[model samples]
Target: MKRALLILAATAVVSAPALADEALAKAKNCMACHSVDKKLVGPAYKDIAKKYAGDAKAADMLATKIQKGGSGVWGAIPMPANPQVNDAEAKKLAAWVLSLK
Candidate 1:
């Protein structure tokens, strides 16, 4: 009983951030082209953060790019403009993606 309770408590703690990530990902349509561990059209979230590792401006740059849309950074496939994501949301999403590292 004690072990089961501990497990349940651990799951509850872990699920919060996972749920938050999923919520933001769904809201931003990130699941359409990206995943936490794998790639679809664009790079994986982990790969993106790795590529931009240690850069102070990564959050800002990524947020702008997410809104503006561009290509050739990762590959020929272009990330479409996401007018749906406002600046604040973009920052949140960008920071989340970068946190994948």
Candidate 2:
């Protein structure tokens, strides 16, 4: 029981950041057009991570795209600019999206 409890605690600690980021994404309405694994209106977070893999400037670029919005890269559907999301939150979301496997 003690070992199980320890494992559960460790799992929670390891998973907390992803959960927090997901909550932030949802709060920011990112979920309306995107998802973690599968493609939605926007590309999946994991697909974004794959496309930007090893790109040193991906976080900055993605953050800018998040705030200003863009099209032609993903599809015909343009992503609307999110004026409500500040620079910091955009960066955080970008980092989180890039972190997805």
Regions of candidate 2 where Cα sits further than 4 Å from its true position: none
Report the C-alpha lDDT of model 2 over 1-101, residue by residue, as the tens digit.
99999999999999999899899899999999999998899999999999999999999999999989999999899999988899999999999998888
RMSD of 2: 0.8
Q: Compared with the true structure, what per-residue lDDT tens digits does model 1 show for residues 1-101?
A: 99999999999997787679669878879789988888998999899999999999999999999899989999999999999989988898888888875
Runs with alpha carbons beyond 4 Å of true place in candidate 1: 1-11
- TM-score (all chains, Cα) for each model: 0.83, 0.95
Clashes of each: 0, 0
Judge candidate 1 against the unseen true structure and give its global Cα lDDT, from 0 to 1. Answer: 0.88
* lDDT measured at residue 53 in model 1 versus the true structure, 0 to 100: 91
User: Could you tell me how far off, in angstroms, the CA of residue 44 lies in candidate 1 after the best superposition?
Assistant: 0.5
